[model samples]
Target: MSIERAFVTQPVPFADALGVLRAAAEESRLRILALLSEGELSVSDLTDILGQSQPRISRHLKLLVEAGLIERHREGAWAFFRLCEGRAGLVDPLIAGLDRQAPPLSEDQARREAVRAQRADAAQSFFARLAPKWDQLRSLHVPETAVEAAVLDVLGPRPVHSLIDLGTGTGRMLALLAPRAGRATGLDSSHAMLSVARANLERLGLARVDLRQGDIHAPPFGRGSFDLVVVHQVLHYLDDPARALREAARLVAPGGRLLVVDFAPHELEFLRESQAHRRLGFAAEQVAGWLADAGLGAVETRDLAPTAQAEHQLTVTLWLAAEALVAAGAERAVA
Candidate 1:
C-alpha cells in the first residue's frame, strides 16, 4: 500500500517524528503500540495480555501517551486507551511493519482475545438481565423493517464518507447503515450498551464501525464531522429533547443529513413510568420546529403507523434534515 493510504494522519514537524521514534524504540512500548492499533484496551487488559505487572504495563502506556501516540479516556472505573488520531500515521506504519506471527505478538494476541472474551461475557450478563423487558416493549413499536427501508430511501445510493449514531442503543442503527458509510461510529452513554453494540458488530465482522461511550447532550465528536447523523428512538428519553436535537444537528457536515426515528405522539403513560421515558412521544410539528431552529432545512417527514389489526401498536415517525453544502466550496475558495 502507498504510504499516504497506510495511515490517515496529517504531516508533523521533524521534532514530533523524532519524539515518536524515541517513544517507540523500547521493547514493551513497541508491543503496546502494536496491540493498541488493533483496538482500544485498558491497563488491566494490557497487563493480562503481556503477562506483566500492572505497573510495568502502565509505564509503557504512559510513555506512549506522553509522546502523543495514544489517547486515554475514562469509562466508569476503567481507563481505556487507543492510538491518538492526530499522530496515528506515525505509529500506524510502525505497528503495521511488525512481524505479527513472530515473537511475543502472536502469544499476546491470543491472551488479548481471552481477556476480551471475559469482558464480553460480563457485558452480556448485564444485557441478559434487561432482555426480557426489551423484548416485551419491542413488540409494541412499529417493525424495524419499515423504518430501515424509509431511512435508506431518504439517504439514497451514494456512499457517505462519515456516519454517526447518537444514543446508538445496541448499535442497531450503525449496523443498519454501515454499508452506506465509509466509516461509522455509534455513541451511547452506557458501557454495557456499548458492549452489546461491540458484540453485535463483531458478529457481523464490521471492522469499519466503531462504538464509543459518550453523552447524548454533549457528544465527543467534532462539529460538522459526520455526513449522516442518526438519532433513533432516543428523544423520548431525554428531558431536554430540543438541546439534544441541536447537538445532533451540530455534527452534520455541510450537504449532509440527519435522520430521527421515534414515536409519533402516543398516550403511553406506562412507558413514562416504567421505562424512564421523559416524553410520551413527540408531535411532527414540534420535531420540525426543533430541526428548523438548529439551522437544518426540513427535507421531508414520514410516518409509519400500524395497521388496523394492531390498535395497541405505536406509530413511528421519521424526520430528515440537510445542512447546506455551500460552506464546503466557500472554504475551499478561501484556502
Candidate 2:
C-alpha cells in the first residue's frame, strides 16, 4: 500500500495526518521507524545503530510517539519503542518504500544485527549460568514437550482473542499459544528474563508479542482485560500462590478462562534452597478454592506425573477455570 492510499483508506483527521507526515519526513526518524518495524528497540539500541547521541535519538522517539507514528513502553529504567498499531497503515507503507539495500539503510541494518547479537549473547550468558539448576528441575518432570502438548489439549481447539502469560519465562508459552490468539502479552518481574524472552520471541518472528517487565503480584493491566490468562510454572516461586491466582483471575474477561500449570503438592524441599522456590507445590483442592475465592468457577484439574520409573520426580498439574459469566452479567446489570 502506498502512503497516500493508507491515509485515504484509513481517513485520519487532517491534523493527525500532517503530524504523522512531519514525524516521518525527517531522514534520521525515518531510519528509526524502519529499524522499529523489524522489532521493538530501546533508545540505546537506536543510538548505537544510528551512531547518534542518546539525547538526539530520544528526541526523535518522542516526536514519533507524540505523532502517533510509534508507541513507547517503559519497563523500569529502560523504555522500548515500536511502531504504533493505530498508525501501522501509514508506517508500514512508508517503511516498505525504503531502499533497504542502499546507502545508510544498509549500514543501519548491519549495526542493528550487531546490537541484537550482543543482546542475544548477554541473554545466553544469563541462561547458561542457570542452566544446570534449570536442567536439574526439568529432569524431575515429565518431558516439557509432553507438558506443553497437554496444555494445548486442555485449551482444545478454541481460538483465543487476547492472552496474557504471567511470569512468562523465555516467552515459550506465548510462542506456543500466540498463533491461536489475536494478540498475546507476556509479563515477568525480572528484566533479564524479559530480555531473554524478547530475544527468543524475536528470533521466532513473534516480535509483536508484547513483553512487559512487571510483578505478578500487581500486574499492570485493568481487570478483565484479556480473554485468556495463563500462569505457567510461576506459582512455586511465590510466597502466596493464592494471591497470584486471584490476580490472574482478575485479568480474565467475562466467559474467559484461566490456565495454571505447576507442580502438584510435593516434598521437594531441596528446591527451596537451590532454586529459591518459596512453595514446594500446591494441591488440587487448594488451587480450586483459590480460584473460587477469585470469583472463577467450573474448575478442573489434570495431573501429568513422571513415568513409573521416575516416581520420585514431581507431578505437573494443569488447572482450568472459567470466569463466572452470570455473576459478571449481574454486576453489569446492577451498574
Among the numbered candidates, top TM-score falls to 2
Worst 10 residues of 1 by lDDT: 1-10
- How far in Å is the alpha carbon of 139 misplaced in model 1? 0.7
Q: Give the per-residue Cα lDDT of candidate 1 at 27.
A: 87
Per-residue lDDT over 24-126 for candidate 1, one digit per residue giving the tens place of the 0 to 100 score: 9998888888877776788998988988999888888889889999888876777888777778677777888889898789998888778878877876898
- How many residue-pair clashes does candidate 2 contain? 0
- Backbone clashes for every candidate come to 0, 0
| Global lDDT of model 1 | 0.81
For residue 124, model 1's alpha carbon misses the true position, in angstroms, by 1.5
Question: Which pairs clash inside model 2?
Answer: none
Clashes of 1: 0
The sequence of per-residue lDDT tens digits that candidate 2 reaches over residues 56-123 is 99999989888888888888899999887788766777789889999799999999989988998989
